[model samples]
Target: MSTAGAHTQHPEHTPGASVRRTREKGEPRFPDGPKADPAGSHFERRIRSFQPRRSRVTAGQEEALQRLWPRWGFDVDGRQRLDLAEFFGNDRPVVLEIGFGMGEATARMAAADPGTNILAVDVHTPGQGHLLGLADQHGLDNVRVGNGDAIILLREMLTPDALGGLRVYFPDPWPKKRHHKRRLIQPAFLDLAAARLAPGATVHCATDWEPYAQQMLEVLTAHPGFENTVADGGFTPRPQFRPLTRFEGQGLDKGHVVNDLIFRRVPHADQPADRAGGDHGADRPEDRDAAGT
Candidate 1:
């Protein structure tokens, strides 16, 4: 018998029949929430820095995504440029947080510093919903959740010097030697990040992977657009502003050493004017690793 005929005959016995019946082609998983693939076909496929994870979203998360997403969240479709001032409804300096897992720390930071706005980007659906819920619960109007690729957000959406600060807490180490190119702290990623960050803005990164931390130090040091905040050009202590996440705490419990790198974006008057537009020639980091904070 043909597969379609069999399914038609035994609709009750067909696997995922209910799901298939409810969801249509090209329809979003959650109609009012972040898109599954926001950047769809607008950009070329390339080596990605992070991998997406398959996980279930909780009831509360689903509710939050449905209710709060329209107000405080947006999909990174790479379709239009965003005005940071207008998006946040204020002229406060906007800090771009590359990957916020579950948004516990992101919420805390937003609560602590209400003066600064945080645009937290992540591909994890549950995390996206959870963050939205947290922001709503805590009345954090300063928090905005961005779905899809951070690279696309930087390259296609945001204007030059659109960010006041950038935070990358515990990005994927990509420990395998063959996968180092997929790490988020590569030279090419730095170039793009530097272009979006305003001069004197701080690019703060933290990680427990020793080798990756060293690589981050080296790359930031070599980049002419950035300067290490520490005079000694070594790892700096984690700042008070950055909350200690449960993931980081667990790594510390296992005797893992966490290194923090705080580099300031410097003015590039002597360099070519086009450098501020970023180097789009290389494969950009797509999303944050699920294992990352």
Candidate 2:
């Protein structure tokens, strides 16, 4: 999907970025909220650690997302609320699909199983209009779109363990090696994602990039709270209702390998802290290795 977000004009990070703190040398806390920086505050720390790349879509293209910002039909709950919540409708299982371009797969899934409600995030306007139209056509009340940074929406806004599952499909690779840091799948993002996922809920990610697939495996495989549910060479067909995007079909024709990574959320022992491969990988019975969607 063409994103509301644009690619970066400059590299987000420079050499020696790791040692430097993005904030002031010695930061003071605000009495009210985070904005009380006695000195004139700079937003570099807030927008992104590195400079955030931005792209300006045409006015027409930007309209849909603008329309979406106001009350988006329904909240996480089955009830009507002014706000969107991770556990919006009491305790109904909520699934999040990031960057649900045009709602093709999302609409199909919601139609297939009306029991589950899906909260989808995307910045693209045309896609939002397309999805909203489709949902209305199908009379699907289960799908909702929250337009903006999926990262911020998940991190700053949502409550912990609030989501039953998550799906990220075909995110921009940001192909340049140096720009790989700009990719959505990363340690920081995973840590936040882990906190919102309920135990037994699955996080599914798919990509057409072979190297990014391996990179995802390397990073997520070591996560303490998530376990892979596939064999060393396991492959799963696209789940039912996942429409074939033009690019995906083209990639298949060109013989590019598509990789899917599915992970299960491991329950936190007692402490509700983030786990990144601490003793969790130790006890699983070697024979119980399973495959995932």
Candidate 3:
């Protein structure tokens, strides 16, 4: 299939000897489809929470990318701001989903809730194609595929309080202690997410890795911008709105204890526009101290 923008190296180039082959000077993998490096050189580089996976795209998936991408897919190029209402052709509240594996759950969620727009972001080419194909197959007009680093989309493309909700399901745990900083649920990420999410919006995250789940809980709890939906300040039961994917089912079969955290964005005094006020009780001293602010 098309490999447009499919470089093996991280987007942020590493110095020294390179192992991956360089494409010829003017070669374009997929001229009419999602770009390989959508946000190339547009923003400062940093440690990323995800790795781009290179896989063989099936004929059907390739066809979907070539045929449907122009209609529903977008490159997170960090070049301009996106008007969510115009992007989805409606004023429906948009929900941002980071790292949808094959997009089965995303498609399901969109099909179930047609009123809410789902902007799913990921770096996997096959999964991107698969999701596109699924969206086309199921007539999921509410679904949109975003290609490239999610951080760029959040930090550059979306405006403050532009999103109604955020979903991070089964993110890479970066299991090694040394690579914990690469984890996506860090305090810095929460800060950015909180800034983009509207007041009272839910930030739902699920993970099977115990340590990562605990870390997510701790960081989210400490953030002054969020408050747990559960009154006990613990993990909440998996809500019906979030479909159980086959990957999650396999994890359950293997006895993995999946933790779902539902934290709501708290309206801040600083954001006058977002001060519609659901619950602003996150200004506690302990929460600020834990957030190291």
List the RMSD of every prediction in angstroms: 10.0, 13.1, 9.4
Per-residue lDDT over 64-157 for candidate 3, one digit per residue giving the tens place of the 0 to 100 score: 6777777788999999999988889987778899999989999988887787788999988778888998998898989999999999999999
Kindly list the per-residue Cα lDDT of model 2 for residues 203-287, writing each as its tens digit: 7788899888888878888888888766563434565445677778889999988877778788787745455223322222111
User: In model 1, which regions exceed 4 Å deviation?
Assistant: 1-27, 270-293
Candidate 1 residues 1-293, lDDT tens each? Answer: 01111112233433222222356788778877788889999899978888998787766676677787888899999999999888899878788999898999999988987878899999999899889889989999999899999999999999988887889998888999999999999899999998888766678899999999999999999999888878789988776667899999999999999998888777778656545324221111111111122
TM-scores of the candidates are 0.84, 0.66, 0.85
- What are the lDDT figures for the candidates, one per model? 0.81, 0.60, 0.82
Clashing residue pairs, backbone N/CA/C < 3 A, model 3: 5-36
Candidate 2: residue pairs that collide: 6-55, 76-88, 76-89, 77-88, 77-89, 78-89, 224-277
What is the lDDT, from 0 to 100, of the residue 105 in candidate 1? Answer: 97
Q: TM-score of the candidate numbered 3?
A: 0.85
Model 2 misplacement above 4 A: 1-90, 231-235, 271-293
